[model samples]
Target: MPTMTAAQRRDLAKQEFDAFLADCPSRLVLDRISDKWVTLVIASLADGPLRFSELSRQLAGVSQKMLTQTLRTLERDGLVTRTVTASVPVRVDYALTDLGVSLQDTVRHLKTWAESHVPQVREAQEAYDRRAGQEVGA
Candidate 1:
């Protein structure tokens, strides 16, 4: 009823941000994207479409079940296309969609950041571990 104060406005903004985070599918999306198999499958499609067997070959150490689940998630996100060709063997190919192509820049940036910061993060972890050990010893 009364005019809101600056602190109230800031609180409102923070609340909105928290609500947005809760509403966003970030956890589900990250659960799918952060997976090693999913990243490999998406990267494989970067060049062009590939049949299921081709994808399996390109991505080493991926189980067929894992690959299937990853592809389904990507397709549901509108990031990948799956086509079944009518043939004697009934081949299927997976390719990145236009939306998925737009994600390349983001993925590349993440890769760059990880490469640049991994050593720093490792150093911090080791320092913490050493301090923790000293406290335990004392």
Candidate 2:
């Protein structure tokens, strides 16, 4: 048997990569990218790199442990890079990779949609609650 080249290996991997499959590796990638922290972190880094403290401040409500975990996951997935600076306090920065940047526009659109549709969503929820109440009475 002949050993496959790098290109051949990549082709084979791509051929077998299917997100719809329960055990497919691509499904894990999808799960990671779909996480709320992942979305926020990626979107926050869209402009440029930010230190851990800065990111925590910008994200508002993210705990330090959660941020650290999300960053580690992003780094593991090759979506973000972590850099350490030789400063007085030793600053660590996180920045999106090219692959991460490719997702920025889509994430931004999702963010925008959520923000703009809140009122409509609230109205829908109220209507749903009223209907549920009527059904309970009936």
lDDT of each: 0.83, 0.92
lDDT of 1 by residue, 1-138 (tens): 889999999987777545257664565676667776766777778789999989989888888998888899899999899999999899899999998888766676666787799999999999999999999999
Each candidate structure's TM-score, on Cα atoms with residue i matched to residue i, is 0.68, 0.83
Number of clashes recorded per candidate: 0, 0
List of clashing residue pairs for candidate 2: none
> Tens digit of lDDT per residue, candidate 2, span 60-131?
999999999999999998899999989998989899999999999999998889899999999999999999
Segments of candidate 1 deviating more than 4 angstroms: 1-20, 112-128
Off by over 4 Å in 2: 1-15
